[model samples]
Target: MRKWLTGAVLGYFLYGLFVYWYIYMGGPDSIPEQFKGTSADPGTFMNSRELLLSGEYSRLRNFMYFITVPYEWFILLNVLLTGLSRKMEQWSDSIAKPDFLKTSIYLFWLSLIVTVCVLPVEWINYRISLSYQITTQSTTGWMKDQVIDFWVNFLLMALLVSVLFWLIRKYQKRWWLIAWTLSIPFSLFLMFIQPVVIDPLYNDFYPLENKELEEKILALADKADIPAEHVYEVNMSEKTNALNAYVTGIGSNSRIVLWDTTLNRLKEDEILFIMAHEMGHYVMKHIYVGIAGYLLLTLAGLYAIDKLSSAVIRNWGSILKIDSKKQIAALPLILILIGALTFASDPLTNTVSRYQEKSADMYAIQLTNNKEAAVSSFQELSKAGLSQVHPPFLIKLFRYSHPTILERILYLEEYHAEEQLKESQD
Candidate 1:
């Protein structure tokens, strides 16, 4: 037991060191000169002084994410959740209810505890965003959103856990395979319904009001061979100032969605470039590819969880009062293990996502034949989103889902003009 505890401690610190290296360690200094800052033409680079943000803006935001996020996810939550799980197990035994119901009750309590424990850090994040004018949602609005998120998560978790535990109890030895198979369809169902069903719960969505811009976007979609029936605009300005647009869902539900902030802030050409980028995602079949990757990861993660959690519960069952995997009280142990696994796998996910994003970027430039628009769009994005121009190598490796704005800009500068000339000649 002592050795196990020592190993756990060592593992946590080692993970922390790895995280520190990724976020703080070796990286390029700044964006390459040609795409360093705002430029009038495609290839012109701005002065270095104009390319980077002032120290005040950069450091504080960087610290908020680089320090706060890791501390909460890795250290505080892990410790708090472990202790909370043990107490929940003890409380469940005392309640003297049916097995499944007892598990449900334990999960309900555990979720509530987690939400409460994390609320302060969430609040700090919001406060920082608010200070930067990134989030415009008032405290009341934010709280309402939180309540909605909490209930939605709790209900889904209840249903999922009930189903999973049922399978475990029934199959005893092969539940992991059953659960993994079930999750594939479940994941697809969620994706299919996300844009239409779940997303509208938080924000109002409407068909894009800009007829001319919508027509242009649709033209781009047609060029990309995607059936973009109608462009949707979400009321993002109600909550945030950040600009974003994406292609989401599958089949009939699939469409392009632009944040109202993006529509309102960006030029028509920039909007076209953005729409083309999202269209590229559809044309490239990245959504399907991403889903396939996730399915494999999910299977592997569930298998690992099954193997590890069984051994863990076997060893600590007497002390933790967890009799079986079917017990709701065992969830925390399962969750903690899953969390660690997910963290470890982040770089792989990020790498794939970044590659897709870069592909989409190239596709956007090709479809639009407007290097200047793409570069300017990126500049606006970095300014609006407060993106790091040149993040540390580790941060890019583990945290960034897409290429850094600066990297994207520099990349576009290299090939945009050549692609445009080829298109013109063709």
Candidate 2:
């Protein structure tokens, strides 16, 4: 066990070292001269000071990206191999009378333990955001959010784990299939409730206060044949300076939301473009597609876990103190496999997400026909978020769900030029 833990720590350290080198030492020396001063200046999007700040911010963010996954895996592995999971299982069993109660108690401990283990990393991330002026939330407010997040996660996970264990004991080998089938509706239920129920817990949400802008957005939605009645805005400025808008939920619960920061920072035309991009997602049915994709992935992952867990128990059951898949003590093993598989699948999932985003971008451009607003909206997004216009290949592969700001701007520019040239010919 010590050997396994040592190797994991060493491997993660080396990986972190490589990530540091790639971010700070190996990447291009500066933002390409083309992108340095285009938007406000004659030929670049950002000034020298902005460029320097963005570069530093991007490096730290990317470094966290590389380290977080392995750190999570290591934490789970340590819990499993050090007999902590078994101990927790025993404690839960002693304290609870009913099977469901026992399962919930065990899951609660597991969630709390993992959250405690990862708190420092979470703190570092929060501190980085604070230093970068990305977030203005006080530490007390942040910790409050963290506590809220923990309970929410614990509740959801406890329910899932209870059902999973029940399925495991009943069907054994077929548990994965049954669990996957159950998760379909379960996942949809979460999505349905998220906007109306879950989101309001974090921030105050209300109708967009600017009646004129709201009317314009509703008009745009009507033009697109969408049934949206009102645009919603969330009080995000109190938390972060980043600009964003998104579509959430489905059917009656479905709505488009704008962050107050987006409304404050962007011009009317720019805000419209952003809204159009989100509307594209709604019209395109990306949310339904995403749900389908998630269900399919969950199906495959649960199956893989079923086989892998059995094999691990057969091989290392004695050392790990996990005798069977039915044991709640196997939760760490299950989570470890899930974490590792999710990490392995990041590139493929990110690629699909990026494609969806690009399609939405094009849709927004065509619907709005405002190339300047579209381009400048992206530039402001980058500036507000300190986003890397050109991240490294690995970072882009694993982390980027949307195209870089530079890519979106260039695509808009090119498409507009093509349209103009065709009009001239006509």
Candidate 3:
């Protein structure tokens, strides 16, 4: 068992390494001096594999334009990668099952259905991710992510499948309930721990420097009617050369993380814009909303499990040891419930996230005291990332959190004009 596990792990590792090096060796002249200031360049790149490393904006534009066409170029790569990764994940799930045939059959049929109906839907979703402000995913790089993503998911999926299957065997009849009940605490633990625990596996993160910038940022916080004394930046370029910034946790643990790419690439104005955006999420208490949503959904899911698993209880209720109020072997039940909930909430979760991101966008523009800068900040982000400028609406509804890159730029442009008019009149 151990050797098999090791071999499986090694297979995934080698696959990922091959994919990464293939793309890396093929990538452009390294991002020349990010974050010292905005790029001397402006425009977009084409998405063909040939231009993956050119780093010219027109090429980027051509790329984004291609992606946007037929529902954006991003859909092809993202959806392909996601499918690949998910299958790799389910590979271990199949391995752990006593009825490997049943698991494989179910997964295959589902993937088939997903291919027919969900593929377009998924394509729309993934296409929308590229419809953001900033990115650098080339056709090849994007394809690489599809590969790396599968390997990552495979690791966790393996762990979950093994653990959950083990619990089901031990519990028997009321196994489903046991699984779900156990999953509640397990998920909760991940919610708090992930910001520290699992995240570091992919990238390096550490404290920020330049006490003066930190102090200035803190003072800016005071101006925004909030109090924050410190911030931390993480090295995101190490993993995949992506740019990102976010505020995670609450109270003492609540610290802002700026990706080195973002920190190194953005100007003071752009940095301020990004920080303000994160601050908007904080001020609006979106994290609280997310946690509250998850907790409520969990309880609802558990109630559902109790009702659904009654038959299992009736048949194998004795071995299960579940009663009106108490349960001894509840792990199996918990796993089933959580699993179902996770799948069910995919759309709802995206909807909520979209709202949160929109709010943050608006707040950042307002708090920064200039709509034009907000526009420019997003533009720089889009340029550096070589993002898709537009996305199909179908994808936006099911998958996206933020407004599309084109949508944001348009909004910022209109807002910029409106603000300028107001100032002129004043």
Candidate 4:
């Protein structure tokens, strides 16, 4: 057991070192040929290169990522050492009269323990964001959001965990399959209501007030046959300087959301290109495809977890005081295993996301047929977001959900070259 634990600890650090080395030490050669190069604009190129190694950038990146290893291990180690989960379960059983009340109290206290333990790290991350001028939210406002988020998570987890354990108790061996079947509707229910029900709790959103921009975005939607009516603008400048735009929801709920910062900082044409790209997401039905993919992965993960957790309980049930699969106290162990699985699968998931993003970029170029607009939009976004132009290869592999800024710009250049050749031939 000690040897197995030692090997797991060593393996985690070794994997992290490998990722860091591939990204920073391997340098440009680590990146694929098709994924290399910067924008043609000399000013953009110079600025990107400078910012990539800037002190503030380095501080922000390091501060954000450096805690991940220790923080993850801390959650698992603290839970195991202190036996917090088992204590919570025992306390809940003693005081609570009913199963529902017991489960709710147990989940609330457990989540609170986890949250309080991690609060310092969360605050430091927020402070770094503020120091870097990435976030505009006040400390008070941030605390408010944190409180709200905690309650939201606690409530959701209470419901879901209660249902999960109930299924486990009832079905035993087939619990995972039943749980997987149940998650599909709950997942869709959340998605369908999130934009309307949940989003308003965090930020104010309104229809894009600029009539001209709204008309233009709608016109692009029409061209793409996307059935979008009104573009939504989120009040994100109040909290962040990050530029972003996305399409979310389905059917009547479907809409494009532009960050206020995007509208304030970028040109009309650049915004148009962004809107077009979001429209591509809608037209391509990426959301549905993404949901389907997630369901499959979730099913597989649950099946594997069921098998692995049984093995774990068989080996260490007495030590951990977790004698049965139905016990809420086993959640910490389950979380640790899930975290390891997620970390291992990052590259595969990121690859799929990057591929979808590339397709959206191409669709935006084709829909708008304004290669210059597409190119300039990417350059502006990279500059405003302080995106790393040449991220380490391993970072691109495991962390990047979209193609790097350099890769996007290079692809636009290639697309423009092909368009120009076709024009000359015609």
Candidate 5:
């Protein structure tokens, strides 16, 4: 048992090491060939780091990122870990899936428990978040919000777990194929509903009063070739001190979202830079590409698990004190599955996301050329959030979807420098 456990754990560690190595080397060789020497303006530009140390900047960066970074990391890790352990069990010699109906019921109940537990823990974490002086919620307010949050998580979990498990059973050996088919629409569905249904749960969305800023964004989107339906603002400050903006939904749900805090907080040019970055994602079709990549990765994982079968399950199931052959493995199966998936695939995922961000940054820089906004936005984001200016490489690979602000600023400064060199020659 020790030998098997040692091998599995060691293998996992080695995989992590490989990911770090891959990302560390992400320095320059990873730059897409098409993007090489592509800047039309290569002007030397200064960074806003020192400026961010000023008073108001502090209010924005840390507080906002606290919730954003953790929330994204937490949910994503849960999903990946569940997938990994399930596949590991499938590869094991011991995996004995619960009977179809019973398996579905068991997995659903376990998911419900996991879903509900998140509320209290998250509320406690919210309290800890307040210790930072960036949060806006009082104890009573927090509890009320937690109640709303609980039901939101419950519904999302129920749907995701139930549908996913049933799909697994339906396809059985061919689960990968079915998953791919469903994931496409699921991505779109989340995109569509999130603006109205999911987002309002966290913060209130209000119509933007500034027709000028709204018009400005719409014009820039047109100039950038960013397809648009409409642009709007959410009253983000009503809930938290954090300032943020996002581009979510597709088709009818596809709308441009700017945080009311951001509009109130950042200057017009800075806001434009932020908007252009999101436009880059839309113009680049990142959503469809991400969905496709997710399908492929998920299918590959299930296929990997099918090859191994049961031995993986018995080994860890025993170690974890989970029932070896009974339906209890269903939950452990789900948990470990998520953990292992994260352990295996996180590196590749982070790399791809980083690349997309770089591309987005390029587009933003091109449209605005307001290097001041780029730098100011960073300071604003950093000060508001209290973000770790620099993170351990492992954390970045495992957790962050967007490039670290420092890395992003560095990229902007580098591109800005190259543009200056070319212009001097002209």
Candidate 6:
């Protein structure tokens, strides 16, 4: 077991090295020429010094994105292989009377173990962001957020673990099907409460403070036939310099939220364009579609987990100290399988997301009739976020949910030209 773990670590290290070299270090030294001067002066989008910094930041972030998956897998595998999970399960059983209580206790220990193991990586990522001037958050503030995140995750996982084990024990063979059925409403519930409950835990949210801007945004929303009374803004500038806006939640809880950073950094027209793009998601019922897609994926994932967990227990139960799939000690094994499956599915999921984002971009441009705003907004976003205008193919495939900034800008230019030609012909 140790040998297997060691071999996996070595393999992932080599993979990380290859990814850093090929995808990170091998990218273009500067922004592509075609992407420049569309929204601003030739060098205004990203000056030479900024370009170098962005490159270094992007490379580190992309490398981390690829390597984190394997690191997570190693953590879980190590816990399972080292008999820590078994020992934790035994301790939980000795302390708790009921099965549910025991499961919760065991899960808490497992969660803490994994969270601690992953903290250094998280801290390093945060420190990198700080060094790049991407985030202004202090180390103390960041650590506080981590604590909040840990507790929040544990509470949610406790509920989920409780339900999951209940399903597992009650319907051994068909538990995955039942769990998947339950996840539909559970998923929606989370989305519904996210805007009101989950979000406020992370950042302070209030109505958009700029009454004039809020009025314009609401006018845009009304034109889209959205019954929105207010646009929301979050205090993101306190944490990060990155600009962002998004539509979140469903039904009555749905809201449009702009980061204060976006509000401060972008022009009125650009902000309107961003809002319109978010509204596109609402108008097209993308949220519902996303929920359905997620549930379907969950159904498949749970089914795979069921099968894979059984196979692992059968093959290496003695070595891993896990006797059955239903045993609490098997949670690490299940997590490892889920992590692997999620990593494998990233490209498929990201492709679908990119398509939806591109569709939204089209909707925003058509609705606003402001091609320049759309193009400039994309450019500003890239500048603020230090995002790669043209990321490597593998990174784009797995990590990117939206079309790259360069792609979006070029698409807008093409659409504008076509529109102008149509007008001239008419």
Clashes of each: 1, 6, 48, 1, 48, 0
Which scores higher on lDDT, 3 or 6?
6
Per-residue lDDT, model 3, residue 61, is 40
| Local distance difference test scores for all models | 0.77, 0.88, 0.57, 0.79, 0.63, 0.87
TM-score of 2: 0.96
Residues 1-426, model 2: lDDT tens digits = 878878888998898888899888876634467655554331266777887788888888788868887888788888888999999999999998888999998888778788998899999999999999998899998998999899888888888888999999999979999999889888889999999899888899999999999999999998888998989999999899999999999889998999999999999999999999999998899999998888889999999999999999999898788999899999888988998899888888988988899989999999999998998898889889988887777778888889877677777878888999999999
Candidate 3 error regions (>4 Å): 1-189, 302-344, 421-426
Write down the RMSD of all candidates, one decimal each. Answer: 3.8, 1.8, 13.2, 2.9, 8.6, 1.7
Candidate 1, run of 10 with poorest lDDT: 40-49
Over 4 Å off, model 5: 1-121, 163-171, 305-309, 314-329
Among these predicted structures, which one has the highest lDDT? 2
Please rank every candidate by lDDT, starting with the best: 2, 6, 4, 1, 5, 3
Residue-level lDDT for 264 in candidate 2: 97
Estimate candidate 3's alpha-carbon lDDT, on a 0 to 1 scale.
0.57
Which residue runs of candidate 1 sit more than 4 Å off their true CA positions? 1-29, 32-87, 90-100, 315-323, 420-426
Q: TM-scores, in order shown? A: 0.86, 0.96, 0.55, 0.91, 0.71, 0.96
Q: 344 in model 3: Cα distance from truth in Å?
A: 4.8
Q: Which runs in model 4 stand beyond 4 Å of their true positions? A: 1-59
1-426 per-residue lDDT for model 1 (tens digits): 345446556766776566555444534435556543345222233334433432234445655555544444444234333465667767877885676676677778878877887788789888878876778999999999999999999888888887888888899788989999999889999999998899999999899998888888888888888777799999999999889998889878887899999988999999999999998888899999999999999889988999998897787666545668876666766777777688789999999999999999999988998888898888788777766666666667767899987678768977866766988999
Candidate 6 per-residue lDDT, tens place, 1-426, comes to: 878787878998898888878774665534466655555332666789877787778888888877787888888888888899999989998999988789889988888888988999998899899999999998888988999999999889888988888899889999999999888889989999999999999899999999998998888988999899989999999899999999899989999999999999999999999999999998998888888888888999999999989988898898888898778888888889888998899888888888899889999999899987898898788878888787778878888989888778777888889999999999
- In model 4, what is the error at residue 164, expressed in angstroms? 0.4
Question: Residues 1-426, candidate 5, lDDT per residue (tens digit)?
Answer: 456446545655665455445434432222234433333111112235433332223223323333333333344234324454344334432443444444444445445555564555566567656765557777887777767766675566556655665665566667656766776678678778888888887777766679888888889998987666467888767656667777777776677789877888889999999999989888898877887887788777766654433455555445443433232345454445555675668789989998998898898999889776887787577566655444555556666678876677778888889999999999
lDDT of 2 at 235: 93
